[model samples]
Target: MALTVPRLLAARAEAEPAHIAISQGADTLDLAAWQARTQAIAAGLRAAGIRPGERVGLLYGPRDWIAYACSYTGVLAAGAVAVPMSVRSAPAELAYMLEHCDARALVYGPAAKPPDVPVELCWGPERISALPEAEPIPGPRPGDAAQILYTSGTTGRPKGVVAAHANLTHGARLNPPLRALAHSRHFLHAFPIGTNAAQTMLFNALTAHAGMLATARFVPEHFARLIERHAVGTVFVVPAMAIELLRSGALERHDVSSVALFGSTAAALPPTVAAELAAAMPHATLVNYYTSTEAAPTQTSMVFHPARPAALGRAAAGGTLRVCDEAGRPCPAGVVGEVWMRGAGIPRSYLDDPETTRHVFRGGWTRMGDVGYLDAAGYLFLVDREGDVIKSGADKVSTIAVEAALHEHPEIVQAAVLGLPDPVLGMTPVAVLVATRELRLAEVRAFLAARLAGHEQPSRIVHVDELPRNAGGKVVKHRLRELFDAAPDPRT
Candidate 1:
């Protein structure tokens, strides 16, 4: 049988009928209820003229738990592909996606107000109840499209990456091992479900019969309470949220003893912050995984090991990774190169951009555009994005390396390093930092001088309360470049 979302839900409903499938604060839905609601919503969409292979956009906040799931599953159940957009996205961004996807219908929560679309279905418990119940329509083939995800577009316009049913299910099965998700685990999903991480969590929860809880928005205090209340076993958080939890002193006050695993993704988690988290949640296992929207979970490392702070782990199950030079030849261990991955789990290509799709995804191997190297032990260590690698003087410096060095300082909470245009050196390295306590330039320079090579160190260090980041907790380096370029040149 082809692996599909509805099929997984049906199997869970049959085997774990009474199991708590989802929880929204005081409200909870068993597997049976979840399946029924999804089917009902699917029937409503069918009745409204949504056909198989059509694209439907799901616009809802993080909280509206069941509604969002119902909308996503409903689209799939009706033989349509679901395109989930971030609630934090600006109207213009949403409009661009909607137009690009040529979405046939938009299923939005009660609170959402999308500008213009062919069809708009208001979704809520009451609205869902009013719709007629219908059986799920099986239309997706193994090779048929399952989802269309927008890349982070750190450099240029975001491209729509399409995943087939086979690719998505295979990747979903592989992710649990990478993040160590178990059947008995209870996962708290506070991040936007539109992203790849959210998709992985949803798939794993349903497949493994794990209890999933969601919050409308990420509130540090509420997250703590939910962990205690639900006995959540695992959680996926971004670096920003981790820093906020550390600063707010919220994790210290709550009984988060039930949390066994904490996973960080979307951005690099500084060793200093990881150490702080390890101190706060001493009993929990902290693992960091790295991947992008174009790819699924690629590498991961378990916390509390001697090598924990050194490198990301090996390639996930069913995936193969290589560090290759400009000519696509494999690089020796300890030498940084472009990270390339190939497996059944990797997505085929971008949705519409054939040229870019061919450029990035070549002959079943997908180029992550990230620079990293593997150790003799086969562990992958990420340095920086290929485009973001700073060329200062004659040295090629990884911004991630500089950022890691800066984050080692006691006063520095977070740091971002990027390359700025320079007439003499082609590009010069600049660093921006956020600090928990007062920090001085001399202290930062001294700290890096002890850790990084002379050429790898940033020429200028700017202090800020917080670094500008996107929804995924990745430092918006483009925005940082704008700010950095506008500042008066230090050499002048």
Candidate 2:
């Protein structure tokens, strides 16, 4: 069979039908049931005219993890493409993704109202449980499009990064799974679906041979409780979740000693946070990996060095990392340059965007736009993204996206957004604006609260007579940062 995941899933069902495959809150589903439901859902899609190679959208919340997993597998089982979108995505963002991927169907959780789409299904609360179990269809081959994950790009528009079936399952099936993960009985994570992180969690659920547990929204306390109650042995969080867990002091409140492995990705783990995470999970091994939308499945390996807690480990199994200067020549140890990666199973292009794909994907390597250097030992270190993509805590806040949201208010004429160093979060987003009306930080926040996520909203806003701009008409972010630093608060 050409299916990497569905094959393992089928094996899990036949070998350990009763084993808990996934759990959320008090709800749990076993491998056999999930398999049956997945097949039934696939049949449902086929019945609805979703043919092979057609793209199907999945917009699911974490609480509905069972439905989410089933839908993901169902689309693949039918040999159709899966395009996952964030439930928190703005309507415009959803519209852009559905249109860009040319999705044929959309599946939403019960808690969320289905977006405006032609063919939609509410795979709501316990709905998958009722579907008749249909025979599983033949799965896709290695070259078939398994998924199209849309990530925010430098231009602030969503770009659909397509992955082959092999690329989708390569990272998880790597021989000699991480020690802590392999021995674990249950794995807990709070990643939102539609993210690469979430897909990794999905792979773990399918093949880790451990029950995968998740929460709807990542609040520190809720995550702590899940670990305490489930005795979760392996857990994964993005840097933002780690920061909140530390700042909230939630670890101290719960008995989380059962956790033996803690992992973070999606952003660099701050050394301070790394040290604190060590203190919090003294028994668990803390590991982080570096990857991008284009350079993924190929990633650095699990690393744990108390001496250099922030170091992203060496190239992952069957992966290679290189640091090259502007001329594309390899840089010597400790010399900064662009980080490029080639994972054996990494996909090659963005769907239908040959120009952009060709720019980043070259010679079987992905040019990760972040600046970084490799040590003599070959560990990668990141300085920053090449542009105004704000690495605010764990969230990849797009300055352009935030500015676009701010521009939605006609009161704001021109806005320049930048990142400020924060102790708790690695960075906090700050905005300096030239507005037509009196705009306060609270007003700016209130305006964006509806448009962007909480982390994307500026922690601080400053008013200026006019934003310093280069002759090319791009607002100079460094000059804007200097302006914000010089004035604690500016009044127009």
What C-alpha lDDT values do all the predictions have?
A: 0.76, 0.77
Query: What are the clash counts of all predictions, listed in order?
Result: 1, 0
What's the TM-score of each model vs. the native? Answer: 0.92, 0.78
State the lDDT at 478 in candidate 1: 82
- Candidate 2: the clashing residue pairs are none
Off by over 4 Å in 1: 117-127, 171-180, 183-185, 297-304, 485-490
* Reference-based lDDT, residue 20, model 2: 84
lDDT of candidate 2? 0.77
> Pairing residues by index, what is the TM-score of model 1?
0.92
Local lDDT at 365 for model 1 = 82
* lDDT by residue for model 1 (1-492), tens: 347767767766776778876778788878788788778888887888888888888887766766777778777877788898877777778878877988887877866767554445434445666886667665567677877887665677777888877776674432233333562458886777677777776776576546777777778898888888778888878877887778777898889888788888777677777887888898888887777777664444445454457567776766788899999999999898899987655466788889988888887788988989998988888888888998877888888888878867766667888988788898888888778766655677787787989878777777677787655657778888777656666667
